[model samples]
Target: MPPSPAQIRSLVTAYLDRHPGEHDALAPLTSALDSAGDPTSRTTLPGHVTCSVAVIDRGARVLHVLHRGTGLLLAPGGHVEAADETLLAAALREVEEEAGIPASALVLTADFRDGPIDIDVHDIDASPARAEAAHQHDDFRFVVHLADDAPDLTLQVEEVGGAAWLPFEEVSSPTLRAKLVASGLDGAIRPVKLEQHAAEHPAPAVRTEPAAVAPAGAPSGTVPNIVGVHLYLERDGHVLLGRRHPDAAYAGGSWHTLAGHLEAEAATAGLVREAYEEAGLVIDPADLELVHTVHMVERPGDDPRIGLFFRARRWEGVPEVREPDRCVGWRWWRAEDLPEPIVPYTRVAIEGIQAGRAYSELGWAR
Candidate 1:
């Protein structure tokens, strides 16, 4: 079902939170929502809410289709329809209808979950043949990560004549282009590529630059085990986890607890810093209790690391995206029902903590 009037209002409010400067530009939309019978209805005068999808690959290329009606290269999009449940769903449906890329192959970026990356308001020419008067479209633009580097595309020849992937800089929408460049998502290497690199360079002695920097001349070929802190914030039988962005150096696009590597500070101090820095949560050291520890190695020949999980008895503020580069958003999951694609050790650590075990080991040879 199409979104209700209240839903439209909430979406506009969220979008404004991100781009406050665009409030004046969106007045028509707000006014429509205020006076409307149905702002999503095609018959609404002045303007209505429309949606577009931007398909970006791991390499940072965006998909554009030659729109048959206008003979212009554009992202897949159209007016909202009754079958759509949300603006984002409408955008995704349009992509599949016009570009033939199934929903299974696309993952919406974290930033797009709250609202569109861009909202473009523009005029549409009158169509005499269809007996439609001139109007405007408050086009909500969303971005999605394409899983495959090269996917077969079957265009709807009636609306889309051809399709091609273009570099991000060449994207037609100036707002979208600027945002994409600033986001640095184009530089993110997918997990599959990281695995391929590890396979090619075997890991006993060689480590990826991000995780392998040796301490100041300690030893010739020695890689030290890095120590990190994890926060286990539980409320009403649920624990918190954040979905790492695809661009993260480790476990990109996977679920993990709030965590960070310890610096020169004490472990508890480091946890407090990371809590505020990553999730906008303020935790007190006195309220923290040592819960569990995991000694883990990602692979057979890789250097090991120590993860110290600490449970916070109390904390201030709700979990939010303070570091977009590392995580998209934080969600609470039941102890028995966790989401998939979670970091392997993270799952183990959570289970151990629940079982009242203080320490566990993983990825070591028997």
Candidate 2:
């Protein structure tokens, strides 16, 4: 049975207090609760949440449906509808609708009392064909299995192009990889680890000379530029910092302030979004005060970027390593005394903040 509304809220609150590490990944759901003060509204956005279920067979082969729209193999699931009474029910319903599998054929495998096995938060880009803005999806993933007496399987013609029972070791989708790890079924046939930074992160060549020519295959007057939004969440004379999962694309194995690239959103909104996504904190734009801006470039032909640093004092939830795949851990460092191996741009911004300076630059000779 689904927990009552009050009980559900209590369960969420307990989960939040106990698993501080899950705050970032669980932010969208929590934020929905905070805004609407109800769990039902979480199924849509400003923050949207969905339920996904991984169905397994007796032979240990996992069930996968080829999504006709995205062309990627994924678990059987979809958006949570109004009629759904609980997240588990929603997961079952999606399995039926997307995979043509009946609820009687499945059994829940994970602890329903412990929220979801995993929650994925990502932006869904808008298409020119669709008159919609980019939005986010917060997926609550569950694991289920075929019943002992269940018969042979079939596929949903409209939603799924194909259905297969495959070994978990063969599932190449990163989305499925994270879910398998969380469910521990990946234990029997461990999935390939894709979070190794050494293979993805590149060490750049140091240079003492500036570029003498335009980038190859570039337009005569066109050059690229980038912008970053960083949070300087401070409280009790300390600021929040996160250690990039040694496998980050750039600056892996480095301590950096909570930051993200600018999207098609305002700087403050992006910061608010990132704070919730990276630290599981709801930062009010009104409470954010600009502290510093770092204009830096890594190499010639590299796009110039402006890092806008904002100090946030008022927010909800304590710091957490929300995106564990991207950041291994989070900490509070005294602004005056920071740890080493900091991202050079971030370190420069902090130094400027401490020195009462406003603007900074790097990777350029004075």
> Highest lDDT among the candidates is held by which one?
1
What is candidate 2's lDDT per residue for 244-294, written digit by digit as tens? 876555677899988876545678987898788777889889999999998
> Residue pairs in steric clash, candidate 2?
197-247
Candidate models: Cα lDDT each: 0.76, 0.65
* Per-residue C-alpha lDDT of model 1 across residues 150-213, encoded as one tens digit per residue: 2589899998999988888898878878777777676342221111111011111112122233
| Per-prediction CA RMSD (Å) | 11.1, 18.8
- Candidate 1 deviant stretches above 4 angstroms: 187-366
Model 2 spans with C-alpha error above 4 angstroms? 1-19, 37-43, 110-115, 127-130, 170-176, 182-366
> What's the TM-score of every candidate structure?
0.53, 0.44
RMSD of 2: 18.8
